[model samples]
Structure formats: C-alpha cells, structure tokens
Target: MTQKTNIQSYITIQNNEIVLNGTSVFKIEPTDFADFSKQAYRNFDVQYPKFFKMDALSKLAFLGAELLLSPITSGEQENNIALVLANKSSSLDTDVKYQESISDQENYFPSPAVFVYTLPNICLGEISIRHQLKSENSFFIFDAFNTEFMSNYSNILLNSNKADVVLCGWVEFFNDDYKAFLCTISKEESTKYTNETINTLYNQ
Candidate 1:
C-alpha cells in the first residue's frame, strides 16, 4: 500500500483577516497591505525583531509559515519537513521597491537587507533558519494558485523519502494586495488534502 499523506492544519491570511480551518481567528482594521501585515505580526507577538526589517513579501511568508507550523514546532522536527511554496508574483513586489530605492540617483541607498528578499525562495530560507530546518526547500512561480502542482510535488517529496513532512501553499504580495495560505502535510492520519480541498480553501 502506498503511504498516505494528510493535511494536519492550514492557515489563510488575506483581506485583513487571518483564518485557521475556516474560522476567522484574527483580523486587522482596514489598511494597506504594509500596515495590515505589520499589525498581524504584532498580534502574533512575534519576538523576532528581524521581522520589522523584512520586506512585505518575506514578512507575509514568515508569519504564515509560523502559524501553519505552530502546533508541532520543536527542535526535533528540524531537517524533517520540506518547504514548498508557490506564488504568482515572484518577489516582484520587493523587486519594485528595490528598484525604486536605487532609482533615486541623488538619494541612491541600496539596502542589503531589502535586497536579500528579492527572491521568493528567500522566505523559505528565512523559515528554515528560524526553525533550523535543513531539508529540501523549493519555490515555484505560476500564473496563479495551482492546486494540482502543490499536491503533486508535495507527495513526491514525501513518497520519495526525502522529507517526513511538507509545508505547502501560496504566499503572494504585490502592491497593496496580499494573501497567504499554508498547509502542513504529513503521513499521520488526519484530514486528507485533495486537489479540490486546496482549491476550496484558497478560493474561500
């Protein structure tokens, strides 16, 4: 029998609201993506000060990863879980900002910190460092939320014995719009994540 994977828990953040398993757990007052993300981090009481320095894309990815991995977070899970995140805008959100920073010929001040997050995969690195995870990590950019790809690739990592758990979902931020939906997948028996389920959750 082929090993089965299950969706342990899922978190979705968008439209100034953060929902877990279809319930609105937290929501910020109406504001732009920047301030809304900042408020979300504050509400989570994230102690990491580096969060303040992160660009909008990284901040959103970091917070979503933290929330999805909160339950079983520990030193033991290190090197066991794979991070597979996807998005439509491949860090262009920060790319534009970085471009603007250097666009000012008179006040040109390129920030290394901001420039570091220019790649969408950097968020995976950030989460890996935060949790000490030394497992397989990859980021893919598509036209939109591709549920088939998310499910297919995650299962490959698990079935291939490369990782015990997989963190799969989308973290997208462009201009004033942003949304993050992350789900943890494991071999343990729980709610199974089918392609339909993924689409439903994302569209919710």
Candidate 2:
C-alpha cells in the first residue's frame, strides 16, 4: 500500500519573528539570540538546560520542530519522525569566517568551533539529538527553493513508507536576513497539504 502523507503543522520565521501553525507566536524587532531564547522558553515551554548548550542553528531547528510536533505528535509517533531540509546558503557564514582566519599567514589557526557549523546538515543532527529522532535524514541545496522539488521528494519518502512522519522545510540564513519555514507531514488528510492550501500558505 502506498503510504499517504498530509500536512500536520508548520512554522515560519521572518523579520525576526516566529509564526507557528499560521498563528504569530512571537515577534521581535532587531532581537538577538538572548531575546528569542527568553521568549521561546516563556511562551513555548522550552526549558534550557544548563549543560549541553545549543547554538543558533540548533535553537532555530529545535523551535521549528517543537512547533510542528506539539499539535500532531504522540508518544510513539515522535520516534518515527524524520527530517529533510534544504537551504541556499549552506553555512556560508561559518565558511567565510573560517576562511578569514586562514587568510592571514601569521595568525592562521583554524578553529574547530567555527569549522563544525560549516556543514549544512549539522542543523539536522542537532535537531535529532534534541528530539531523540533516529530516522531517515537528508539535506540538499539549490540556487533557490523549488516547491516542486520539495513536494516530490517528500511525497516519495512518505509514499514508500520510509518514514511514518516527516519534517521538511527551507531554512536560509544570509548575512542579517534569516527565513525559515517548516511543515510536518503524515498519513492523514486535512486542510494543510492540498495543492491550493500549500500555495495559499506560501503566498501569505
């Protein structure tokens, strides 16, 4: 039987604000990580542990997953969740900083701290760790987001029954501009995954 999948929930972050499941969760103008951290914990029930601190990418992915999972996921279903993401700038900020450190001959010491974030897939790893999800994972990049590509890829994974649930989106961070959109997909029908529904969501 071909596994079916439907849109479960979605979150979008732009203009230094977060919108979850089509509702604005928090909006911060010119806010930093600390500001977001506080708001996320307060409004979303996120408890930041003292140890195993997370970085910016991890935090963003975590929040995105949390929002998507809250309304749709149950105990066992969470374990079956998978993550697939795509972005245009694949950790370019870290790549640039790493190259800058090596540019000068005298002070050319490459920092591992900056090196680890150079890969685009680290965000997926961070999210998996946060949620303890051990399922299929993939990361891809293109010059720009192709909705057709994303929809086809996601449909293939779900239709093949490779994953019981999938978390997918486009997360692009360039310079000071950051935009993220995530949606959860499962084998159910509702108002979220239809062609017209997705188009409306993107158009909004």
Candidate 3:
C-alpha cells in the first residue's frame, strides 16, 4: 500500500530570515527568540491574540506553520492530516523558563499560560486549534535532523490508512538560536520527498 508522497509546501525560518520554499519572505533584527518571533509574527500579520501568551518554542513553531500552511484552505478531509515534529531541545527552553518562574522561593509565582507550553506538542495543539485539524500528531527529540526518520514515518502514514496528510519536520528553539523546517506531505505527488531534497531545503 506504499504510495508516493509530495511536498505540498515547506517553510524554513532561521538566521534572521524566513523562507517559504526557495523564496525569501522576510528578515528580522536577529535578536533574542522572543523579540524576533514577535517581529516575525507581525510581518506575517497574524491576528491571534493567544500568540502572545505562547512560549518562545510555541511561537517559533507557530510562525513557521503559519508562513507555510495559513494560505491553504483545508477540505473536509483536513481532519486526516497529521503533525510530526522533532527537536533537539524539546521543551527544555520553556522548561527552564517555567522553572525560573517557580524556583524563586519568595516570588514563587508560576504563570499558567507559561506552564501550558512546557511540552513541545502544545504548539501542535495551537495549530490544530487554528486549522481545526483533528489528526494524528507526534513530537520527537533528536540530536540532529533525521530526514530518514521523517521520510519513513510519513511513508507509513500514507501507506496505511491512518492519515491522508502529514505536517512534518523539525521545530527547534534554544535561547536566541531557533529553526523550524516544516512541510505538508500528501499523495498528490508534487515535489519529491527525499533525503537529499530535505537536506538541501533545510540548508537553504
């Protein structure tokens, strides 16, 4: 039942730049993750009030997803789309922030909004909420980008009946360094989904 999967659209955000496919979309001040994400959010003209309450990790993931997937109107089968994201830092960045918020014995104040994003998958939830996509999604932690893993898992999703599409890739953020390389996978067979292509796209 294995079938071809295509890269519908992909976006990479890093090094003070945002690129959708091979085209440069925007550039920023290259500041900290917080400030840069705020600027990028504005550049995309996203009107989500909840975006402000999201942690740095969520913001990075959200922006990348928005830059790529926002324009496409989903069909009734959108619920069959899957989300598969991986990262080296996982939620450590926000975990540290959350810890610092409660580590202080005197202040000892933990913001519920901040605490909510302690898991990396919360970003996926935010995307699901925005697009109303009810589908299978997973978050992975890796030392590096495992293109092979992503390709293989996506193949499984398509070969089986578990999913009709998958939004898969890496979303990593640590301090001022962050990157999100995300793409939509479907059986439409537009752009070939291969290791070489993903590596080239990620490096571009």
State which candidate has the highest TM-score: 1
What are the per-residue Cα lDDT tens digits for candidate 3 across 57-158? Answer: 788888888766667646454567788999999899889988998988999879998888899899999988877888888899899999889878887887
Candidate 3's error at 44, in angstroms? Answer: 1.8
Question: TM-score: which is higher, 1 or 2?
Answer: 1
Q: Give lDDT tens digits, candidate 1, residues 25-124.
A: 8887798877887788888887788888778878888888888776667976455889999999999988998898899899988999888988999899
TM-score of each: 0.92, 0.84, 0.91
lDDT of each: 0.85, 0.73, 0.82
Model 2 earns a TM-score of: 0.84
Assess the local accuracy of residue 6 in candidate 1 as a C-alpha lDDT between 0 and 100: 77
Question: What is the Å distance of residue 197 in model 3 from its true position?
Answer: 2.9
Q: Model 1, 99: alpha-carbon shift in Å?
A: 1.0
- For model 2, the local distance difference test gives 0.73
Per-residue error for 169 in candidate 2, Å, reads 0.7
Runs of candidate 2 with Cα error greater than 4 angstroms are 1-4, 32-45, 49-55, 70-78, 192-199
Q: How many backbone clashes are present in model 2?
A: 0
Candidate 2 clashes between residue pairs 3 or more apart in a chain or in different chains: none
Query: Backbone clashes per model, in order?
Result: 0, 0, 0
